[model samples]
Target: MQHFPTGQAEHKRHRRLARRNANGIYNWIMTNDVFYRKVLAHLKHDYSKLEQHARELEQANVALEQDNVDLRNALLAKEQQTAELQREIEAQTKASGACTRRWPARRNQVWSDGWNRLTNELAEAEATKYREKSKTRRRKIKALKNRVRTAVATSNSFEQWLLFVEQEKQDVETLLARYKKKLQAQNRIMTEARVLARELRRSAESTIFNSSTTVNSWCSTFERGIAHVIVAGELFSTSPATSDGSSCLRSDSELIYGMSTLEGLETARRGSPFSRSS
Candidate 1:
């Protein structure tokens, strides 16, 4: 590490003694322009970060909306499937007309007492066997209907599927609502960020305007002091070493100290010559 001389830092502090004005902060900022620029950079970084986060929230909101759409589409498909299932249940509950078309009856049988007076005994026996088989098939069909009715009454009822679909839809709605709430919150944050950024910009603008005004005022004051010094046109000199080994300034034999010393250097320059030539 580089080390400063014992008195070098003190001398530098002495050099900067008159740098500050009545407005302490503005003078310090004018002297150190780096601090002002650092403040600007911080504001810019904060605004950029806020904008980036707002964009991310917008993208997330879009994705969530798309997911909600997909959920709605799925719900539509489920509703269509449920409708088809209901139609199938109704069709199964009632016998189809296709079977009637398959078992076409003879028109002449009604004239002969509806197939009761058959000439061939073998034909009659075949009809009887057919009737028995049809009875057994009808009994099986009734048993299947009973099973289907039991299934409808039990946990496998249509209401179960409808309830499940409703539950899924409700869940999707809930998720969508939750996402909407998050999106709204993000929007609010983004809005607040925008407001904050605007406020920061205004604050920076005000600070710059105030600093410039202060700098102009300081310049005017310095000009007046320089004009007065020029009008005096006398050379000022430092005094002899005092008892404390510190030099006292004797401008026209006046002992000045602290804040007033910087403000009144012209009074000393008018009375004494700092350097004399033979």
Candidate 2:
């Protein structure tokens, strides 16, 4: 049982060992690649969703801004209507005052006395000659009374219209105030949504960047590992060419260097973003 393997058999064994190690590393690298790919896909999906949400928020803000503009326009129109109504009210008030002044209570007696004197003068004339004149005078007095009554009716109507207009103005003011409050609330909501979307987008981008960087670092490490394995295999295959121990020493040193490089990559990976949290 103290028999040693032949040189050819020993080389075959080394080849098998190297192949097995390479296979294991390849499988490990594949697993890590799949994992990182899944992570990247997930991050991309999350970022896409956040971007969609941000777009929706932007649309909502646009709608809100349009609504604010419409509200402001309506408010301006209402103000204009109110001012016009005020002017009409003032004009009506002046007309009503003028109508009142035209028929003053203190002048009522004077008007009656004048009418009586004119009637007495008409009666003193010949009856046949003054009949048509009396009829014309009566018609004139009736027309004057109608005019006074029309003025009074107009004044009353103006008062009613003024009251209605005042009520409408108050209602418009109330509505304007409500619109202002609603517009303010909408603006606040829009601002908050924008801020939330911005923060979410920033966070998503940062996370994706960090994840991408980590994946790249891991990929580089795996690539270096595969390269080192290939070089090591080449050295082992060539080692049989020389009958000196230096070949084995060189292989050992290359392995040590590869291990040290792997250790450094592992250290770097541990210092990555995700690892920092852990």
lDDT of each: 0.54, 0.63
Task: Report the Cα lDDT for residue 100, model 1.
Answer: 54
Give per-model TM-scores: 0.26, 0.28
lDDT of 1 by residue, 1-278 (tens): 22336344554554476354445555554544654365557667877887898899889889889989998999999999999988987786554555455435434446555445555676888999999999999999999999988987885666887888887677667656654654554455445434433443443345445655534444444454454334233222322343336644444323222123333433322211221111
Model 2, 1-278: lDDT tens digits are 12224544644555566577876666655655665576667668888998998999999999999999999999999999999999999999999898778767648877888888888877766685678888999999999999999999999999999987887677667656654654454455344434433443444446556777555555554455455445545543543222222322333444554465455446544544557668
Q: What TM-score should be assigned to candidate 2?
A: 0.28
Worst 10 residues of 1 by lDDT: 269-278
Error of 1 at 99 (Å): 61
lDDT of 1: 0.54
* Clash tally, candidates in order: 0, 0
Report how far residue 149 has shifted in candidate 2, in Å. Answer: 2.4
